[model samples]
Target: DVKVTQSSRYLVKRTGEKVFLECVQDMDHENMFWYRQDPGLGLRLIYFSYDVKMKEKGDIPEGYSVSREKKERFSLILESASTNQTSMYLCASSLYGFNQPQHFGDGTRLSIL
Candidate 1:
């Protein structure tokens, strides 16, 4: 079974602070993704990586960045967090193919004060 774990389930941060959200997958999937969930916007992809050190920008990548130095680990970086950036962030991993089922972490609810 694949297990995706986020570093924190809930986090609090102040505006302008740099934040790092970590995710790890035990299944050794080749593709990992970062997304944010909001009420009206639904789930928007922030970034994705297909291999170590290779990243691609997703739908919403303006204020976010990603790092995947290792196959099993992916990190989401918020350069300068703002109140509008507060949301439920999710981490997911899948096999290297189309239509693959992705395993997702529980999510981290981030609040920016």
Candidate 2:
């Protein structure tokens, strides 16, 4: 089974602090994604990496950046945490395209004060 692990299950940050969320997958999948899930907004993509050192901006990428130096790992960096950025961040992995359903980690609920 494809497994994705998130660095934190919950996080609390100040309004302007920089935050990093890490994700690791054991499936050796070529595609990984970072998304923020909100109550009524569903899952909105933040960033995605198809290969090592390559990344694509998703629907919402403002104030956020990503790194993929290794195939099995991806990281989401929030340059400055804000109250609006306080949401459930989810990390997912897939074989490649939209055909395969993404396997998601437990998710990290971040709260900005």
lDDT by residue (4-107, candidate 1, tens digit) is 99999999999999999999999989999999999998889999999999999999999898999999999999999999999999999999998999899999
TM-score, candidate 2, is: 0.97
Which residue pairs clash within candidate 1? none
Tens digits of lDDT, candidate 2, 1-113: 88899999999999999999999999999999999999899999999999999999999999999999999999999999999999999999999877989999999999999
Total clashing residue pairs per candidate? 0, 0
Range of the 10 consecutive residues with the lowest summed lDDT in candidate 1:
39-48
State residue 82's C-alpha deviation in candidate 2, in Å: 1.0
Off by over 4 Å in 2: none
lDDT of each: 0.97, 0.96
> How many Å off is the CA of 76 in candidate 1?
0.3
- In candidate 1, residue 60 scores what lDDT? 93
